[model samples]
Target: MSAATLVGSEAPLAQTHDVALVDLDGVAYQGHLPIDHAASSLGAARDGGMRLVFVTNNASREPEDVAAQLSGLDIPTSPDEVMTAAQACAALLATRLEPGAKVLVVGGKGLVTAVERAGFVVVRSADDAPDAVAQGFSPDLGWGDLAEAAYAVAGGAWHVASNRDLSLPTARGFAPGNGSLVAAVVSATGVEPDSAGKPSPTMYRMAVDRLDARRPLVIGDRLDTDLAGARSGGYPGLHVLTGVSSARDAVLAPPGLRPSYLGADLRALLEPHPAPQRADGGWWRCGDRAARVVGDGLEVDRQGPQGIDVVRAACAAAWAAADAGSGPAPQGVADLSA
Candidate 1:
């Protein structure tokens, strides 16, 4: 996890996760689940509406793979809707590097392939590190290989890290990520590499430019990468609890690290003007909102606009419905509600 500095430490005047009403296709989307709603929002925006691009800092996977992963989570997304730091490196070098310039890699195939596809020739540097070590979740790394990379970086090879996340979570537990490996190189070489992940304007510029999107909104799970990245890019970020950062992080979050909006998942804003009403009957009344047993599936217009309360009630409903063995929430609420 990124240590908390003053929020907006990098960009003092940038808006943190301050959220507000935004319209798409003549309807209002609560904008809490930005990542979940990204694809549909972009599509709807274009058809006489608006657009958004999901700039993700997680660099282990390419754009297509990331989109596929999100899809499995029931997030409606497209390859064009996702941009990873791996892809950013490719886009960054595209304009700066000479065609097919020799480059050394320090991450995984995602980063390597991104560079190669960008027309750079990736060569193992004279520095002895295994070129690059793919470290994330369960990294198959050896001390000798890391020692080699340390030597190579000390020897003057340019080092590129796919991301700077300290750990990635899995079914098992937290594990070291590329950021830890890059630390070895930094320690040996006294050279800080240009991080290609979140909070790096280089990565955000790539995704924003790719979609030619203006006034775009960013969405993701981690406050360190996603919210900070949005701050760097002068955009708003929506934080969701399904992934990395948790409710505790939001409450204790330093200023810059807080999200503009928060949601249980992408489904929070699928409907417009969701209101929770308890009637005398066993059935309650919720209109212009999606429902499930998990959270109140119930909408409270009064949840504080900022921080995790931003969507706590929604989460409560979803969690409740889930315990009741509810099937997927009502479908056909217009795919854009995510």
Candidate 2:
């Protein structure tokens, strides 16, 4: 659907969607710690009859380990409720390579287990004469691992990467993720690996199939990964502010990256969404908030009862202005919280 045609619903989102495909890093936990309200809100959503599935691009940890982490955080989950990019990458590789084909693993035990489960033999070095190379993220990975992947790819082994997320959030701060490591191999071999994570539609499709969801909502913090993947997979997405992207980033998002719903956090699933309607005098109204385009600039005419409403109105107005080519690109949202 076009961004201009998007509208909010009077019914609570929890009642509308059968399942929620939730991203892990930014939405549920920011590294090793769980985000505020994440556990409770998700539990409430589950109580309200909405199923929750944790979808992560991080391929370093196995599904069972990820489930254990979430369970320890008070959000009980099973391995079946979690989907990783490594699983998706392995599935993709299985379709191209013969059963029991030797595949060089360039990442962690997670990727190795995934490839092996898909009936491929996992090898460590290019000297193994592997038929393909699969890479993911692992803290234990080093220059030696990248060199092996590069050699394999340079020698014409089909290469696959779990995801291309350049940076990962950690308790200390941002650190290089799988994408940065993948770039090392790319620079050495001058060949790009086929990605099987977010923005590829492969992972989303797998999640949908696994959940058997008739109507699923994609929830995440990153626009480039989660929202982009939802859009590519023809699913509705909700962008939450509890993680990476801010209100300013959401308002300025391009057509493909814009989310269908914007919320402060997962609590939005229980609340009725206020539609932004075009108002008199070229204004847009959402709940008690209003915004307007004034000669290549955006002006906030009224702040809503809640800060999120104001953000919603501003996003609608800015996206409308962008579609009509009547205003400059939305720089930021005034009076909106991050």
Q: What TM-score quantifies how close candidate 1 is to the native fold?
A: 0.61
| Worst 10-residue lDDT window, candidate 2 | 327-336
**Clashes (N, CA, C under 3 Å) per candidate:** 26, 0
lDDT of 2 at 161: 93
- Model 2: how far residue 80 lies from native, Å: 0.5
TM-score of every candidate: 0.61, 0.95
Please, what are the lDDT tens digits per residue for candidate 1 over residues 66-90? Answer: 5665555444457776666777666
Regions of model 1 farther than 4 Å from truth: 1-54, 71-78, 94-96, 127-138, 271-338
Per-candidate local distance difference test:
0.50, 0.86
The best candidate in terms of lDDT? 2
Q: By summed lDDT, which 10 consecutive residues of candidate 1 come out lowest? A: 20-29
Best by TM-score: 2
What value of lDDT does candidate 2 attain over all alpha carbons?
0.86
Query: lDDT per residue, candidate 2, 1-338, as tens digits?
Result: 54423468789899999999999988988888988888999999999899988999988789999999999998999999999999999999988998989999988888888999999999988998889999999999988989999999999999899999999888888899899999999999999889998877788889899879999999999998999998888899999998777887877777888899988988888888888999999888887888777877778865335488878888888888888877645544454673
